[model samples]
Target: MLEQSTRSERGSMTGEEARRAVREGRLSCQTSSLAPGYVQGNLVVLPQDIAGDFLRFCQRNPKPCPIIGMTEPGDPHIPDLGVDLDLRTDLPGYRVWRDGELVEEPGDLLSHWRDDLVGFVIGCSFSFEEALLADGLEVRNVAEGVNVSMFRTSIPCAPAGPFAGPVVVTMRPFSPADAIRAIQITSRFPSVHGAPIHIGQPEQIGIRDLSKPDYGDPVAIRDGELPVFWACGVTPQAVIAAARPPFAITHAPGAMLVTDLKNSRLSIL
Candidate 1:
């Protein structure tokens, strides 16, 4: 867990500053609280051969795979996201997968860059967190200095080519009133996974244990609070694994690419 005192400092950091810290090896932890108003994104890199299919997959399932930015074949920079955003190194951590299995968890992707790779930056729920906070609702993972809990659900995504898999969701416990407010607040930010897909009853979504999440860390669910679920950007990792792509790369759960785009810019209102 991170010190609560640094929360303010992290919130004050610019996207570039946070990315620089990750690149310089100064910060390599869950980025839920850093660059508070900036758009943080989940990273997915695939070979040019399969990139088209993956793009269609994202288009088919916009809720969990909303595309915020994308890179040309073999390119590392996304000019719209950040002037100096290097997809190869901006994120704090990365997962390397081969034949549908995780093979490495590296801090940087310097050695893995290839001419055939294409990068995709998927909109993350973190971008809407600021709105939630501004509305006076607590974002538990940020308060506890832990990654938000994520689970694989029985709900299936609309498949595109080989990218078929179950929907993945992030859980945040909230009072019934706050949950409704949260839904209203997040609905304006559709690019960052708009609203809750499930309000309560974890088993209805096939989540057997709230304490044991499929990805990320579980947080306390206090009395009178309902476990609200939102579509997660981590859905791609699960899709990639099921598709058995020969090679793929993704941001580690909770560690995302901090973009220059502000979270407010994503709101429709």
Candidate 2:
């Protein structure tokens, strides 16, 4: 367990340290702005039988469902992502679903673990945020201490078997000029949802209100700032729910699996 005195330094914690705190029950909160430079992932666990279709679904929708790492059937660790990363407890939170209905949000998956389950770690947009901040752009959620605003959009993802749903997106308000720069900056991290899919008007993408986001918290938009949308990793949560698999588990939105991999490693340029 992390010492109580180290709590204030959580923002600077290494990926392994952060995971240690989370696994030890010392921390339980949305992990946005934590462990900067480490790649964070959205978690999805499913029965081994249906893992193939879900993998194809990710392949078909690379922007929102990029595969960063995965575990073998019944395995709880992803060595490439983190040497000691445990799917059962590294994340701050977990969402358990059954028959398309959310059953519980647990702190750990110890009770739900099964011998036939498979885990997938999807790349998170939060990983590319370091590049945005390094370039001097304000990441509203980080600045405001909140999870990035996410919403379901009208844009449909290419379906693969039972996995299919409208694309979910994360929004950040920025000036017209900054939006373009954000696009250029984010375009380098293709594995972590590269580039904005839409800018300015949210309604064109089926988002009716900026204040009321479907997942995570909404940030304030400035006078000249426009709402920029990026395809989000949370899309799989929606897809899994709509598919109504008998059993499935995902990281709670905003609560991600912090991995040992660095953000710089994912950059194409």
Off by over 4 Å in 2: 1-5
Question: Tens digit of lDDT per residue, candidate 2, span 49-126?
Answer: 999999999999999999999999999999998889999999988999989888999989998999999999999887
- TM-score for each of the candidates: 0.90, 0.92
The window of 10 residues in a row where model 2 has the poorest summed lDDT is: 1-10
lDDT of each: 0.90, 0.90
Best by TM-score: 2
Tens digit of per-residue lDDT, candidate 1, span 1-269: 34332667787899998888778777777887788789989899999999999999999999999999999999999999999999988988899999988999998999999999999999988778889988889989878878889999999999998999999999999989999999999999999999888989999999999999988898998999999999998898789988999999999877889999999999999
